[model samples]
Target: MTDGPATRYARAARTWAPIDWWKLEARAVYERPELRRALAPFAPVEAWRDLAKDVATAWGILLTLSHIAALTLPVLAGGMLLGWLFQRDDLAPVGLTGLLAGIGAVLAGIGLVTEAREPTGTDPRIGRLIGGLHLVPSTLGLLVATLAISLGSADAPLGVVAFIVDVGVGIAYFVLNRGPADSGSDRGRRNLARLERALGELPPTDRARMEADAREAIDVLELRDLVGADDAARAREQRLGLLAMEMAPRTDLATQRR
Candidate 1:
Protein backbone atom coordinates (compact mmCIF):
# COMPACT_ATOMS: atom_id res chain seq x y z
CA MET A 1 0.00 0.00 0.00
CA THR A 2 1.19 3.51 -0.77
CA ASP A 3 1.96 5.74 2.18
CA GLY A 4 2.37 9.49 1.92
CA PRO A 5 0.53 12.78 2.28
CA ALA A 6 -1.39 12.18 -0.90
CA THR A 7 -2.61 8.84 0.28
CA ARG A 8 -3.64 10.25 3.63
CA TYR A 9 -5.51 13.04 1.91
CA ALA A 10 -7.33 10.51 -0.23
CA ARG A 11 -8.34 8.54 2.83
CA ALA A 12 -9.53 11.65 4.59
CA ALA A 13 -11.48 12.72 1.54
CA ARG A 14 -13.27 9.40 1.52
CA THR A 15 -14.07 9.59 5.21
CA TRP A 16 -14.92 13.29 5.15
CA ALA A 17 -16.25 14.32 1.79
CA PRO A 18 -16.06 17.90 0.36
CA ILE A 19 -12.80 19.01 1.93
CA ASP A 20 -11.09 22.15 0.65
CA TRP A 21 -8.53 21.05 -1.92
CA TRP A 22 -6.28 24.04 -1.27
CA LYS A 23 -6.06 23.24 2.40
CA LEU A 24 -5.34 19.61 1.65
CA GLU A 25 -2.60 20.56 -0.80
CA ALA A 26 -0.96 22.92 1.68
CA ARG A 27 -1.05 20.34 4.44
CA ALA A 28 0.27 17.67 2.09
CA VAL A 29 3.42 19.66 1.31
CA TYR A 30 4.85 18.65 4.67
CA GLU A 31 4.78 15.01 3.58
CA ARG A 32 6.82 15.75 0.50
CA PRO A 33 10.45 14.65 0.73
CA GLU A 34 11.62 17.93 -0.72
CA LEU A 35 10.28 19.93 2.20
CA ARG A 36 12.01 17.70 4.73
CA ARG A 37 15.31 17.88 2.90
CA ALA A 38 15.09 21.66 2.65
CA LEU A 39 14.51 21.97 6.37
CA ALA A 40 17.16 19.39 7.35
CA PRO A 41 20.09 21.71 6.72
CA PHE A 42 18.70 24.26 9.14
CA ALA A 43 17.38 21.96 11.89
CA PRO A 44 19.66 21.07 14.80
CA VAL A 45 20.80 17.45 14.85
CA GLU A 46 19.55 16.92 18.39
CA ALA A 47 15.94 17.71 17.40
CA TRP A 48 15.94 16.92 13.71
CA ARG A 49 13.94 13.70 13.81
CA ASP A 50 11.19 14.96 16.08
CA LEU A 51 11.12 18.25 14.25
CA ALA A 52 10.62 16.56 10.91
CA LYS A 53 7.75 14.48 12.25
CA ASP A 54 6.02 17.35 14.05
CA VAL A 55 6.38 19.70 11.14
CA ALA A 56 4.95 17.15 8.78
CA THR A 57 1.94 16.72 11.02
CA ALA A 58 1.19 20.37 11.74
CA TRP A 59 3.10 22.74 9.48
CA GLY A 60 0.40 23.53 6.97
CA ILE A 61 -2.59 24.08 9.23
CA LEU A 62 -2.26 27.84 9.35
CA LEU A 63 -1.62 28.10 5.64
CA THR A 64 -4.66 26.00 4.97
CA LEU A 65 -6.74 28.36 7.09
CA SER A 66 -5.42 31.28 5.12
CA HIS A 67 -6.28 29.45 1.94
CA ILE A 68 -9.89 29.34 3.06
CA ALA A 69 -9.90 33.10 3.48
CA ALA A 70 -8.35 33.62 0.06
CA LEU A 71 -10.90 31.34 -1.50
CA THR A 72 -13.85 32.93 0.27
CA LEU A 73 -13.08 36.58 -0.36
CA PRO A 74 -13.62 36.26 -4.11
CA VAL A 75 -16.87 34.33 -3.73
CA LEU A 76 -18.22 36.83 -1.21
CA ALA A 77 -17.32 39.73 -3.46
CA GLY A 78 -19.11 38.13 -6.39
CA GLY A 79 -22.16 37.38 -4.30
CA MET A 80 -22.38 40.95 -3.06
CA LEU A 81 -22.19 42.16 -6.65
CA LEU A 82 -24.98 39.79 -7.64
CA GLY A 83 -27.16 41.07 -4.78
CA TRP A 84 -26.55 44.70 -5.76
CA LEU A 85 -27.30 43.97 -9.42
CA PHE A 86 -30.58 42.27 -8.44
CA GLN A 87 -31.62 45.50 -6.67
CA ARG A 88 -30.85 47.57 -9.83
CA ASP A 89 -32.20 45.18 -12.54
CA ASP A 90 -28.68 45.00 -14.11
CA LEU A 91 -27.93 41.36 -13.26
CA ALA A 92 -27.33 40.25 -16.86
CA PRO A 93 -24.23 42.41 -17.58
CA VAL A 94 -22.57 42.05 -14.17
CA GLY A 95 -23.59 38.38 -13.90
CA LEU A 96 -21.67 37.49 -17.07
CA THR A 97 -18.47 38.98 -15.65
CA GLY A 98 -18.97 37.04 -12.40
CA LEU A 99 -19.63 33.86 -14.36
CA LEU A 100 -16.41 34.27 -16.33
CA ALA A 101 -14.48 34.96 -13.12
CA GLY A 102 -16.00 31.90 -11.47
CA ILE A 103 -15.02 29.72 -14.41
CA GLY A 104 -11.47 31.08 -14.27
CA ALA A 105 -11.28 30.33 -10.53
CA VAL A 106 -12.41 26.75 -11.11
CA LEU A 107 -9.86 26.28 -13.89
CA ALA A 108 -7.04 27.70 -11.78
CA GLY A 109 -7.98 25.54 -8.83
CA ILE A 110 -8.09 22.41 -11.02
CA GLY A 111 -4.69 23.23 -12.49
CA LEU A 112 -3.19 23.76 -9.06
CA VAL A 113 -4.63 20.45 -7.86
CA THR A 114 -3.27 18.66 -10.93
CA GLU A 115 0.18 20.15 -10.46
CA ALA A 116 0.23 19.19 -6.79
CA ARG A 117 -0.39 15.52 -7.59
CA GLU A 118 2.75 15.12 -9.73
CA PRO A 119 5.30 13.05 -7.84
CA THR A 120 8.64 14.52 -6.89
CA GLY A 121 10.24 11.19 -7.82
CA THR A 122 9.87 11.79 -11.54
CA ASP A 123 12.87 12.68 -13.75
CA PRO A 124 13.55 16.41 -13.58
CA ARG A 125 13.08 17.14 -17.27
CA ILE A 126 9.97 15.01 -17.56
CA GLY A 127 8.56 16.42 -14.34
CA ARG A 128 9.05 19.93 -15.61
CA LEU A 129 7.32 19.12 -18.87
CA ILE A 130 4.37 17.55 -17.07
CA GLY A 131 4.21 20.38 -14.59
CA GLY A 132 4.10 22.95 -17.38
CA LEU A 133 1.30 21.08 -19.07
CA HIS A 134 -0.66 20.88 -15.83
CA LEU A 135 -0.25 24.62 -15.33
CA VAL A 136 -1.93 25.51 -18.61
CA PRO A 137 -5.33 25.98 -16.99
CA SER A 138 -3.88 28.21 -14.31
CA THR A 139 -2.11 30.32 -16.95
CA LEU A 140 -5.31 30.68 -18.90
CA GLY A 141 -7.24 31.50 -15.75
CA LEU A 142 -4.73 34.20 -14.95
CA LEU A 143 -5.33 35.80 -18.34
CA VAL A 144 -9.09 35.49 -18.05
CA ALA A 145 -9.04 36.96 -14.56
CA THR A 146 -6.95 39.88 -15.77
CA LEU A 147 -9.44 40.56 -18.53
CA ALA A 148 -12.42 40.22 -16.22
CA ILE A 149 -10.89 42.62 -13.73
CA SER A 150 -10.17 45.17 -16.47
CA LEU A 151 -13.70 44.98 -17.88
CA GLY A 152 -15.39 45.49 -14.54
CA SER A 153 -15.73 48.46 -12.20
CA ALA A 154 -13.23 49.50 -9.51
CA ASP A 155 -14.98 47.19 -7.03
CA ALA A 156 -14.70 44.27 -9.44
CA PRO A 157 -15.33 40.83 -7.97
CA LEU A 158 -12.54 39.34 -10.06
CA GLY A 159 -9.92 41.32 -8.14
CA VAL A 160 -9.92 38.85 -5.26
CA VAL A 161 -10.30 35.98 -7.72
CA ALA A 162 -7.20 37.16 -9.55
CA PHE A 163 -5.32 37.37 -6.26
CA ILE A 164 -6.22 33.76 -5.43
CA VAL A 165 -4.94 32.60 -8.81
CA ASP A 166 -1.74 34.56 -8.22
CA VAL A 167 -1.27 32.71 -4.94
CA GLY A 168 -1.77 29.39 -6.77
CA VAL A 169 0.96 30.35 -9.24
CA GLY A 170 3.30 31.18 -6.36
CA ILE A 171 2.63 27.82 -4.74
CA ALA A 172 3.39 25.98 -7.97
CA TYR A 173 6.62 27.93 -8.38
CA PHE A 174 7.73 27.05 -4.85
CA VAL A 175 7.00 23.35 -5.22
CA LEU A 176 8.81 23.08 -8.54
CA ASN A 177 12.19 23.30 -6.82
CA ARG A 178 11.23 21.23 -3.77
CA GLY A 179 12.35 17.66 -4.36
CA PRO A 180 12.88 14.85 -1.85
CA ALA A 181 15.84 14.97 0.48
CA ASP A 182 18.46 12.32 -0.30
CA SER A 183 19.92 12.61 3.20
CA GLY A 184 19.31 8.96 4.11
CA SER A 185 21.50 7.56 1.34
CA ASP A 186 23.94 10.44 1.78
CA ARG A 187 24.39 9.77 5.49
CA GLY A 188 24.74 6.05 4.83
CA ARG A 189 27.54 6.74 2.39
CA ARG A 190 29.31 9.00 4.87
CA ASN A 191 29.11 6.42 7.65
CA LEU A 192 30.51 3.77 5.33
CA ALA A 193 33.37 6.07 4.41
CA ARG A 194 34.22 6.71 8.05
CA LEU A 195 34.18 2.98 8.80
CA GLU A 196 36.50 2.24 5.88
CA ARG A 197 38.96 4.95 6.94
CA ALA A 198 39.07 3.53 10.47
CA LEU A 199 39.58 0.03 9.10
CA GLY A 200 42.67 1.23 7.19
CA GLU A 201 44.58 1.33 10.52
CA LEU A 202 43.96 -2.36 11.09
CA PRO A 203 46.08 -5.31 9.81
CA PRO A 204 45.33 -6.43 6.22
CA THR A 205 43.25 -9.51 7.07
CA ASP A 206 41.18 -7.78 9.75
CA ARG A 207 40.78 -4.72 7.56
CA ALA A 208 39.61 -6.84 4.62
CA ARG A 209 37.15 -8.80 6.74
CA MET A 210 35.72 -5.77 8.58
CA GLU A 211 35.45 -3.73 5.38
CA ALA A 212 33.57 -6.51 3.62
CA ASP A 213 31.15 -6.92 6.54
CA ALA A 214 30.59 -3.18 6.78
CA ARG A 215 29.91 -2.92 3.05
CA GLU A 216 27.39 -5.70 3.18
CA ALA A 217 25.68 -4.22 6.22
CA ILE A 218 25.49 -0.81 4.60
CA ASP A 219 24.01 -2.22 1.44
CA VAL A 220 21.32 -4.16 3.29
CA LEU A 221 20.30 -1.56 5.88
CA GLU A 222 17.20 0.62 5.52
CA LEU A 223 16.98 3.78 7.58
CA ARG A 224 14.22 6.35 7.55
CA ASP A 225 16.49 8.73 9.40
CA LEU A 226 20.28 8.94 9.72
CA VAL A 227 20.45 11.13 12.80
CA GLY A 228 18.46 12.12 15.89
CA ALA A 229 16.80 9.82 18.44
CA ASP A 230 14.64 7.50 16.40
CA ASP A 231 14.35 3.85 15.48
CA ALA A 232 16.40 4.33 12.35
CA ALA A 233 19.01 6.20 14.40
CA ARG A 234 19.11 3.38 16.95
CA ALA A 235 19.49 0.82 14.20
CA ARG A 236 22.45 2.68 12.75
CA GLU A 237 23.99 2.95 16.20
CA GLN A 238 23.61 -0.79 16.69
CA ARG A 239 25.21 -1.47 13.33
CA LEU A 240 28.23 0.63 14.23
CA GLY A 241 28.40 -0.99 17.66
CA LEU A 242 28.48 -4.42 16.06
CA LEU A 243 31.35 -3.30 13.82
CA ALA A 244 33.25 -2.02 16.88
CA MET A 245 32.69 -5.33 18.66
CA GLU A 246 34.18 -7.18 15.74
CA MET A 247 37.27 -4.98 15.83
CA ALA A 248 37.74 -5.23 19.61
CA PRO A 249 38.59 -8.95 19.82
CA ARG A 250 41.31 -8.74 17.20
CA THR A 251 42.71 -5.54 18.71
CA ASP A 252 42.91 -7.18 22.14
CA LEU A 253 44.71 -10.26 20.77
CA ALA A 254 47.21 -8.04 18.94
CA THR A 255 47.95 -6.07 22.14
CA GLN A 256 48.52 -9.30 24.13
CA ARG A 257 50.99 -10.58 21.52
CA ARG A 258 52.82 -7.24 21.55
Candidate 2:
Protein backbone atom coordinates (compact mmCIF):
# COMPACT_ATOMS: atom_id res chain seq x y z
CA MET A 1 0.00 0.00 0.00
CA THR A 2 1.25 3.49 -0.84
CA ASP A 3 1.71 6.04 1.95
CA GLY A 4 -0.46 9.15 2.02
CA PRO A 5 0.93 12.57 1.09
CA ALA A 6 1.32 13.51 4.74
CA THR A 7 3.08 10.20 5.45
CA ARG A 8 5.35 10.72 2.49
CA TYR A 9 6.14 14.28 3.64
CA ALA A 10 6.92 13.03 7.13
CA ARG A 11 9.20 10.31 5.80
CA ALA A 12 10.97 12.79 3.55
CA ALA A 13 11.55 15.08 6.51
CA ARG A 14 13.27 12.30 8.52
CA THR A 15 15.60 11.08 5.76
CA TRP A 16 19.31 11.66 6.24
CA ALA A 17 20.87 14.40 4.14
CA PRO A 18 24.57 15.20 4.07
CA ILE A 19 25.56 18.85 3.74
CA ASP A 20 29.17 19.77 4.56
CA TRP A 21 28.97 23.17 6.20
CA TRP A 22 32.64 23.06 7.22
CA LYS A 23 33.73 22.59 3.63
CA LEU A 24 31.39 25.41 2.54
CA GLU A 25 32.83 27.67 5.22
CA ALA A 26 36.38 26.73 4.23
CA ARG A 27 35.60 27.53 0.61
CA ALA A 28 34.04 30.83 1.61
CA VAL A 29 37.18 31.66 3.59
CA TYR A 30 39.36 30.94 0.57
CA GLU A 31 37.19 32.84 -1.87
CA ARG A 32 36.05 35.70 0.39
CA PRO A 33 38.30 38.40 -1.01
CA GLU A 34 37.78 37.45 -4.64
CA LEU A 35 34.03 37.05 -4.15
CA ARG A 36 33.87 40.51 -2.54
CA ARG A 37 35.88 41.98 -5.38
CA ALA A 38 33.65 40.32 -7.95
CA LEU A 39 30.52 41.60 -6.24
CA ALA A 40 31.83 45.12 -5.51
CA PRO A 41 30.45 46.48 -8.76
CA PHE A 42 26.88 45.72 -7.72
CA ALA A 43 27.27 47.09 -4.19
CA PRO A 44 26.10 50.57 -5.18
CA VAL A 45 22.77 49.27 -6.47
CA GLU A 46 21.95 46.66 -3.84
CA ALA A 47 18.22 46.01 -3.44
CA TRP A 48 18.77 45.78 0.30
CA ARG A 49 19.34 49.54 0.44
CA ASP A 50 15.78 50.31 -0.59
CA LEU A 51 14.47 47.51 1.60
CA ALA A 52 16.37 49.00 4.54
CA LYS A 53 14.62 52.35 4.08
CA ASP A 54 11.20 50.70 4.14
CA VAL A 55 12.12 48.70 7.23
CA ALA A 56 13.31 51.79 9.06
CA THR A 57 10.15 53.66 8.22
CA ALA A 58 8.06 50.76 9.47
CA TRP A 59 10.11 50.54 12.65
CA GLY A 60 9.56 54.23 13.35
CA ILE A 61 5.83 53.97 12.88
CA LEU A 62 5.64 50.97 15.19
CA LEU A 63 7.36 52.87 18.01
CA THR A 64 4.81 55.68 18.06
CA LEU A 65 3.56 54.64 21.51
CA SER A 66 7.07 54.98 22.90
CA HIS A 67 7.40 58.40 21.30
CA ILE A 68 4.10 59.54 22.81
CA ALA A 69 5.11 58.38 26.28
CA ALA A 70 8.50 60.05 25.97
CA LEU A 71 6.96 63.37 24.96
CA THR A 72 4.09 63.23 27.48
CA LEU A 73 6.24 62.93 30.59
CA PRO A 74 8.01 66.23 30.02
CA VAL A 75 4.77 68.08 29.46
CA LEU A 76 3.38 66.62 32.65
CA ALA A 77 6.48 67.66 34.59
CA GLY A 78 6.25 71.16 33.18
CA GLY A 79 2.65 71.36 34.30
CA MET A 80 3.63 70.52 37.86
CA LEU A 81 6.32 73.19 37.82
CA LEU A 82 3.86 75.79 36.62
CA GLY A 83 1.46 74.79 39.38
CA TRP A 84 4.23 75.21 41.95
CA LEU A 85 5.13 78.62 40.60
CA PHE A 86 1.56 79.92 40.87
CA GLN A 87 1.16 78.45 44.35
CA ARG A 88 4.28 80.16 45.68
CA ASP A 89 3.37 82.47 48.59
CA ASP A 90 6.87 84.01 48.66
CA LEU A 91 7.04 85.31 45.07
CA ALA A 92 4.99 88.35 43.97
CA PRO A 93 1.72 87.39 42.21
CA VAL A 94 2.38 89.35 38.97
CA GLY A 95 5.80 87.86 38.13
CA LEU A 96 4.78 84.35 39.21
CA THR A 97 1.60 84.60 37.11
CA GLY A 98 3.63 85.66 34.08
CA LEU A 99 5.89 82.63 34.61
CA LEU A 100 2.82 80.45 34.91
CA ALA A 101 1.51 81.76 31.60
CA GLY A 102 4.85 81.00 29.93
CA ILE A 103 4.74 77.45 31.23
CA GLY A 104 1.18 77.16 29.97
CA ALA A 105 2.28 78.09 26.48
CA VAL A 106 5.06 75.50 26.70
CA LEU A 107 2.63 72.77 27.72
CA ALA A 108 0.14 73.79 25.03
CA GLY A 109 2.86 73.75 22.38
CA ILE A 110 4.09 70.32 23.36
CA GLY A 111 0.49 69.08 23.46
CA LEU A 112 0.03 70.26 19.91
CA VAL A 113 3.22 68.48 18.88
CA THR A 114 2.00 65.33 20.59
CA GLU A 115 -1.39 65.58 18.92
CA ALA A 116 0.23 66.03 15.55
CA ARG A 117 2.30 62.90 15.97
CA GLU A 118 -0.59 61.01 17.54
CA PRO A 119 -1.36 57.80 15.64
CA THR A 120 -4.81 58.69 14.34
CA GLY A 121 -6.64 59.38 11.15
CA THR A 122 -6.54 63.13 11.31
CA ASP A 123 -6.25 65.72 8.58
CA PRO A 124 -2.68 65.70 7.32
CA ARG A 125 -2.57 69.46 7.00
CA ILE A 126 -3.71 69.94 10.58
CA GLY A 127 -1.22 67.40 11.82
CA ARG A 128 1.56 69.17 9.94
CA LEU A 129 0.46 72.50 11.37
CA ILE A 130 0.45 71.05 14.88
CA GLY A 131 3.84 69.47 14.34
CA GLY A 132 5.22 72.81 13.17
CA LEU A 133 3.91 74.30 16.41
CA HIS A 134 6.59 72.33 18.32
CA LEU A 135 8.99 75.23 17.99
CA VAL A 136 6.71 77.04 20.39
CA PRO A 137 7.45 74.58 23.22
CA SER A 138 11.13 74.22 22.32
CA THR A 139 11.61 77.97 22.53
CA LEU A 140 9.20 78.38 25.44
CA GLY A 141 10.81 75.70 27.59
CA LEU A 142 14.20 77.38 27.39
CA LEU A 143 12.82 80.79 28.12
CA VAL A 144 10.65 79.52 30.99
CA ALA A 145 13.51 77.56 32.46
CA THR A 146 15.70 80.62 32.33
CA LEU A 147 12.95 82.66 33.92
CA ALA A 148 12.43 80.10 36.67
CA ILE A 149 16.14 80.09 37.41
CA SER A 150 16.04 83.89 37.63
CA LEU A 151 12.91 83.72 39.84
CA GLY A 152 14.73 81.57 42.41
CA SER A 153 12.16 78.71 42.26
CA ALA A 154 13.80 75.33 42.63
CA ASP A 155 10.79 73.46 41.16
CA ALA A 156 11.09 75.14 37.78
CA PRO A 157 14.71 74.02 37.40
CA LEU A 158 13.73 70.44 38.17
CA GLY A 159 10.93 70.63 35.66
CA VAL A 160 13.30 72.04 33.04
CA VAL A 161 15.76 69.22 33.74
CA ALA A 162 13.00 66.67 33.14
CA PHE A 163 12.03 68.51 29.98
CA ILE A 164 15.62 68.43 28.72
CA VAL A 165 15.94 64.74 29.54
CA ASP A 166 12.68 64.05 27.76
CA VAL A 167 13.93 65.96 24.72
CA GLY A 168 17.12 63.93 24.73
CA VAL A 169 15.04 60.77 25.08
CA GLY A 170 12.84 61.91 22.23
CA ILE A 171 15.87 62.31 20.01
CA ALA A 172 17.17 58.89 21.02
CA TYR A 173 13.74 57.39 20.38
CA PHE A 174 13.68 58.84 16.90
CA VAL A 175 17.13 57.45 16.21
CA LEU A 176 16.00 54.01 17.35
CA ASN A 177 12.84 54.19 15.26
CA ARG A 178 14.86 55.14 12.23
CA GLY A 179 17.03 52.14 13.15
CA PRO A 180 20.52 51.57 11.76
CA ALA A 181 20.80 51.68 7.99
CA ASP A 182 22.01 48.06 7.98
CA SER A 183 19.10 46.86 10.13
CA GLY A 184 17.23 45.26 7.23
CA SER A 185 20.34 43.50 5.99
CA ASP A 186 21.04 42.16 9.47
CA ARG A 187 17.46 40.98 9.80
CA GLY A 188 17.55 39.38 6.36
CA ARG A 189 20.71 37.48 7.22
CA ARG A 190 19.19 36.22 10.45
CA ASN A 191 15.98 35.17 8.68
CA LEU A 192 17.91 33.35 5.96
CA ALA A 193 20.06 31.60 8.54
CA ARG A 194 16.96 30.49 10.44
CA LEU A 195 15.13 29.31 7.32
CA GLU A 196 18.21 27.45 6.12
CA ARG A 197 18.48 25.60 9.41
CA ALA A 198 14.78 24.74 9.37
CA LEU A 199 14.45 23.69 5.70
CA GLY A 200 17.83 22.00 5.56
CA GLU A 201 16.44 19.17 7.70
CA LEU A 202 13.65 18.51 5.19
CA PRO A 203 13.87 16.75 1.81
CA PRO A 204 14.46 19.04 -1.17
CA THR A 205 10.87 18.92 -2.45
CA ASP A 206 9.34 19.39 1.00
CA ARG A 207 11.82 22.18 1.69
CA ALA A 208 10.95 23.93 -1.57
CA ARG A 209 7.22 23.57 -0.94
CA MET A 210 7.52 24.91 2.61
CA GLU A 211 9.61 27.84 1.43
CA ALA A 212 7.04 28.78 -1.20
CA ASP A 213 4.16 28.58 1.29
CA ALA A 214 6.02 30.51 4.00
CA ARG A 215 7.14 33.20 1.59
CA GLU A 216 3.57 33.96 0.61
CA ALA A 217 2.50 34.23 4.24
CA ILE A 218 5.54 36.33 5.12
CA ASP A 219 4.77 38.78 2.33
CA VAL A 220 1.22 39.26 3.58
CA LEU A 221 2.22 39.66 7.24
CA GLU A 222 5.10 42.01 6.45
CA LEU A 223 2.83 44.44 4.64
CA ARG A 224 1.52 45.68 8.01
CA ASP A 225 5.06 45.41 9.40
CA LEU A 226 3.88 42.72 11.81
CA VAL A 227 6.71 40.40 10.90
CA GLY A 228 9.83 42.35 11.70
CA ALA A 229 13.28 41.27 12.91
CA ASP A 230 12.12 40.57 16.44
CA ASP A 231 10.85 36.99 16.42
CA ALA A 232 9.75 37.26 12.79
CA ALA A 233 11.61 34.10 11.78
CA ARG A 234 10.15 32.22 14.71
CA ALA A 235 6.69 33.49 13.81
CA ARG A 236 7.14 32.38 10.22
CA GLU A 237 8.27 28.94 11.38
CA GLN A 238 5.26 28.70 13.66
CA ARG A 239 2.94 29.64 10.84
CA LEU A 240 4.48 26.99 8.62
CA GLY A 241 4.29 24.44 11.42
CA LEU A 242 0.59 25.12 11.78
CA LEU A 243 0.12 24.24 8.13
CA ALA A 244 0.93 20.61 8.97
CA MET A 245 -1.81 20.54 11.60
CA GLU A 246 -4.19 22.03 9.07
CA MET A 247 -3.33 19.37 6.48
CA ALA A 248 -3.25 16.41 8.85
CA PRO A 249 -7.00 16.24 9.42
CA ARG A 250 -7.75 16.58 5.71
CA THR A 251 -5.35 13.73 5.00
CA ASP A 252 -7.06 11.58 7.63
CA LEU A 253 -10.47 12.20 6.00
CA ALA A 254 -9.06 11.24 2.61
CA THR A 255 -7.65 8.03 4.12
CA GLN A 256 -11.08 7.17 5.67
CA ARG A 257 -12.79 7.55 2.26
CA ARG A 258 -10.19 5.34 0.62
Q: After superposition, how far is residue 63 of candidate 2 from its true place, in Å?
A: 5.5
Instruction: For candidate 1, write residues 40-122 as lDDT tens digits.
Output: 33232432353255553222443333344334434443445445444544322333434444443455354335334421122
Q: What does candidate 2's lDDT look like per residue over 1-258, in tens digits?
A: 223332232233322111111111112222223222221111222212321222233334434433353344334444444555567654322233334333434444454354334322122333333332333343345455656678775443444444444344344323322322221333223333433343344555654554454444334334545435543354345433233222122221212100
After aligning candidate 2 to the native by TM-score, how far in Å is the CA of 174 from where it should be?
5.6
Task: Compute each candidate's TM-score over C-alphas.
Answer: 0.25, 0.29
Give the C-alpha lDDT of model 1.
Answer: 0.36
Model 2 regions more than 4 Å off? 1-65, 79-139, 172-209, 212-258
**Residue pairs in candidate 2 whose N, alpha carbon or C atoms collide under 3 angstroms:** none
Worst 10 residues of 2 by lDDT: 17-26
